[model samples]
Target: MSLRTQLTEILPPLLPSNPSEAIKGTELIRLARLQLNGAYSDASLRYHFSIMSCDPASPIAKVEKGQGYYRRSAPVPALTGAQELLSLSQGRLDDLSSDHEAVDSALERLRKFRAVVTRYYEVNGRFPYVFRQAFAQGASLGNLWKFPEVVLVDWETGDAPDEVFALDPTMLSLKQRLGLPPFRLHAARLRIHPSLASFREDFFQALSASMWAQGGELIYAAPVEDEALADGLRRLNAIFGVGVISFGLTAQALDDLPRAANILNAHPRETEALMDRLQINRIAAPHTRQHIDWQSLDGLRRESEEVQHLIGWLNDCVGKGRAEAFRDEA
Candidate 1:
């Protein structure tokens, strides 16, 4: 089958075959397209093309454009093992990828697709590419990639509870791939579940705009911090009135930005986790300004996209009722 046909077949019936044409050459949405594919990229990978090891120097997969889109080059070859894993998640998709080989193919595609459009609404102000095929096993899942404040626990105070949660690696990779602006997590407190860490990104992103635009004393009506968050979270908990909000999100993907504050307020699990990140234990690192890794700001600037992706996933709970098709990828 044709690449376009394959993309149309496997994708959630909504994506366009000629995304460039449909998006009118926008770079922002180009990232979205990449993520849509990554949404399918998971550790429980379905086929050989879904792996990331194929691209040795860099990661590149066959991106099919319209017919005759390639002037001289041919489509990418069918890969086996890592290459195949890097190619596609589904058999049909792999069959449809490029047969051509190029050193800087992925980089070239990034440049070529610069005209792609992007979305303006801050889906948590964070980028949307952090989740990808190999992300979960990588380095930054849960406490591993937490904010400095998160890692600092008081040896004297007793170790905090270790939190564990599941997420789609490929979807996470998508967040890292497309770096969006940074956002914050406003909540009651922290806990072990990875959801709280994610809350920080989404909560902050929504507030950044509202606070920046409205100039607020902040609504304690919602949970901006962990301790006082519950009163705020219940609003969203009752929304659909079903499923475990802690399992994922109270905020949904297409959820209205205005509603997020309330939805976040409704989901206290994530907020409490944020509070946990902020806790000052007797650990030598200390919460005092002295131990803080202010220098990380530079790195964080570079990683803001990952942060955004985190927020997007966190927010997807209430608005969209889940992360961006991540479980399949993770």
Candidate 2:
């Protein structure tokens, strides 16, 4: 059967006598045409019919313009809102000879798009508004069009979760494939100062003790310089096939510790509290040290409470063996 005839069989009937209904019916047909041909330049039966009978100022004209916008806004050459719609039509195209291959190709294209989007998120800590909006609209249409499988797969892979930790080989591979930076690189990006190295080592010792109390084994516990620690973590990550959590004591240490997956600051409780207050007040990190009111008892109390809360949260993350405990509440 012709693609148009097949589409008409499944789509709801629209009365030819009613202009509005006809416009809607023709749009559905146009979408099908775009899907099959990969472009809208070719004239189809519906296109010719519209040219002959459809009103010049009909709503269909607006939809046609919108479709053009959708195509032009594609992030990658192979993906656009129209192509996404095509991918969602996989199950409905079962009768088409090339359905399986077409669906697989569409899926692979979507995956590549996903990889780019994931990388953007990792670098910026948020999705670009245009792309996010496109994905949101696509997801809504996928459901409205009864393509549940498309929605399901996209949700499982495209959505980013909070506080991902690297602990195992599988997780490491998944993170790398998704464009997430390793712990060491992520920490280095934070650009924390070197004055806090002693604090980091102390924090690690405390954390190690807490884990040991909970029956978690500590394979390495020596106090090494920041570079040595980073090297150790890299070795452990490669040889032991696990994520390495290491500390850098100086600004230069971060450069040296390329293999560490997680780098934490080792500030005193009071210092941490002050930093928390600055962060809560939207103060820039560079200005935090100068802005803090050290002698304000009320401010001190508030900062202390914030520090305690952070420590408690970290404790929970350690207990759960998942970094998601650190995600800010929405």
Overall lDDT per candidate, in order of appearance:
0.25, 0.28
lDDT of 1 by residue, 104-211 (tens): 343222121110101111122222221222122233333222321111011111122331122334444454466421122221111112112133332332222122
Best by the TM-score measure: 2
Which pairs, if any, clash in model 2?
Answer: 183-261, 184-260, 184-261, 194-250, 197-249
Report lDDT (Cα) of residue 326, candidate 1: 23
Cα deviation in Å at residue 240, candidate 1? 22
Q: Which segments of model 1 are wrong by more than 4 Å? A: 1-76, 81-101, 107-129, 133-330
How well is each residue in 61-134 modelled by candidate 2, as lDDT tens digits?
21221121101110112233333433322222223234666555444433333332223233333211112222
* Superposition TM-score, candidate 1 onto the true structure: 0.16
lDDT of 2 at 170: 52
Per-residue lDDT of 250 in model 2: 24
